[model samples]
Target: MDRWTWPAWVGVFGGLLVFAGLFLPAVVWQSRRYGRLSARRLLGTAALAVYGVALIAYTLLPLPSGDLAQWCAEHGVGGVQLHPLQFIADIRRDTAGLGLRSTLTSVAVLQVVFNVLLFLPWGIFARGFAGWGVLRSTVTAALASLLIEVTQFTGIFGLIGCSYRLGDVDDLLTNTLGGLLGALVAPLVLRWMPRPAELVQDRGRARPVTALRRWLGMLVDVVAVSVLGAGLGIGWTLVGYALGDRTASAPEVLTGLLPVALVLWLPLLIGSGASLGQRAMWLEPRWSTGEGLARGNLPRRIIRGLCGAGGWGVLTLIHGAGPALAAFVLITALAVPFTRGRRGPSCALTGAELVDARAVSPAVPRAAASTDR
Candidate 1:
């Protein structure tokens, strides 16, 4: 790969993610601070993203080590550079015989630059997002490098059977130095960031009813439920296999019902009247106005879930996922336009109503009020 190519790829990918962040408000109706991301959060999120990208690139790029890797494994050997300044020594040797141009073209020179530059974001992120000071940032940088080197040194913890890359002490030094430099310069580059302490907090987003918000929340729920179901089903099957039970099965209902129950129960139990989906959309199911949800309306929530995703899943399980899935999606989607306020056809099934759960002042209890006086 060209020296500049990896950074360019990171730039393009990171730019796309930033662009996607703009649409998050349309999909998610609430967050810690909803709507727009403050400058601090934006910078913090961006720094996090860039750091993650560099980490992946540095550790895992030049994939498919192929036959050479297998040969090395058979021979029981791999590359290592335990001595510090090995990079400088190699560069100096090349330049002495072949001139300075030889040093510029050398892979050793690029390795030093990329290794050092790769970790700069770690220092910036430690201070900027995590609120670590200089000393903490340096320690964090050292720890991170140690982990990376160990991973390389062990060949992805022996799964690959041999190390494909050289684990070098100089890389650690350069990476730590890069992080320290980034930490030192972070205040200047991030001067415009908003301090969360001084900034206004979100009370959540509320509107009479919004179809898009409702859809977005439901979408998040669908993904959550699917992931939950798959995890449960897969884990059960694996457990059964490990125990040597030939008849062990991973049931579809096990996947669907458990996740559905937890999603409905936990948040309501937490005194948030919202399900995971409703919370994402900043709307909650309310049996009555101004009520705390210590115990929820399980019947209503389950009814809504069935109407949204649980129903579709049951159909898929019973009818076998092809035409039934397609038909359900079409009918539900077309029904939205005819339904008043797009509140969903199922909302009427159990007399359940979706309420905007944002911005109402918390009601003080009588005992607490009296104690305050």
Candidate 2:
């Protein structure tokens, strides 16, 4: 129970860390590929992360430590059980002259069951979540089982210098069988999961801009600016150390200037005039009444930038302005839901509308038709 419980807890902790790290990237990918996020798919992704960590924890955890020779002699499990279906004979011998319940409860029988159940999720995930065929899932499961067996036999590729667990051929066979069974039942188990093809079918079509989408995009921009600032600070400190200037510190101006460039200058000069976060969320700014973001539209672009994430970035650099920045962010977030097209503070202020980047402009079709004539 301790062994199982410990690994389960470890899996939960590690899984959450994995989920947190992948959350933003996964959201970005889904928004781009599916034109909208699916809560069900996101939940599935989270489950996958937990399962992945649990797999590692159960297989290779509680590593051998301290007084290697003594531990190996007294407690270590070594050598290979190469005979196929050996567990059947072992179970039968142990259960001789015993009742049905006793046989079922015996260690030999239970071990085989545990091994089988361990690989079951692999087939389910491969077939249902990953959309793999039955044969492929089964074969892959077999390969994974084989790898685990080899690793155990070689004592984690000679890391511990001796095997700490038996490499059993019976375990491999049972594990593969479990995976095959799982694959066969995957459809029934995962009936609610959306097909990848269906999700991407209308990916190029426009989606309505929502407050949640706006908030997520803003979050991405904030995170990007923070990451960029941290990275630049680190680089500056490293360069200073390399130059033997122990007292050298990052310049206040460069940190502020670079973030402004990232959120403001670069987007204005580049395609679609969307911040990095907005682009990731498949959103862009468009003039509400007339021309798109063109070279001659410098003033509008500047106004939009100053009112959006770029402005936030600049404000963050000012000393003793934390409260003001917080207020600005809070007000903008609150304003999003009330604004037309769910526009953020920037769009509302500049008379620009937020739209899905994939949405085709109304004038594009007419211009193309004219060219054909």
- lDDT winner among the candidates? 2
Local distance difference test scores for all models: 0.63, 0.80
TM-score of 1: 0.68
Candidate 2 is scored at a TM of 0.84
TM-scores of the candidates in the order shown:
0.68, 0.84
> 126-222, model 1: which lDDT tens digit per residue?
7765567988998889888988887777767776677756687888899899899878887776666654444444343344555665676666666
Range of the 10 consecutive residues with the lowest summed lDDT in candidate 2: 364-373
| Model 2 per-residue lDDT tens digits across residues 236-307 | 999999999888888876666786677656887776778888888887776633433322267887788889
| Model 1 bad stretches (over 4 Å) | 1-54, 60-70, 73-80, 97-107, 129-131, 160-163, 187-212, 245-248, 264-273, 287-353, 361-373
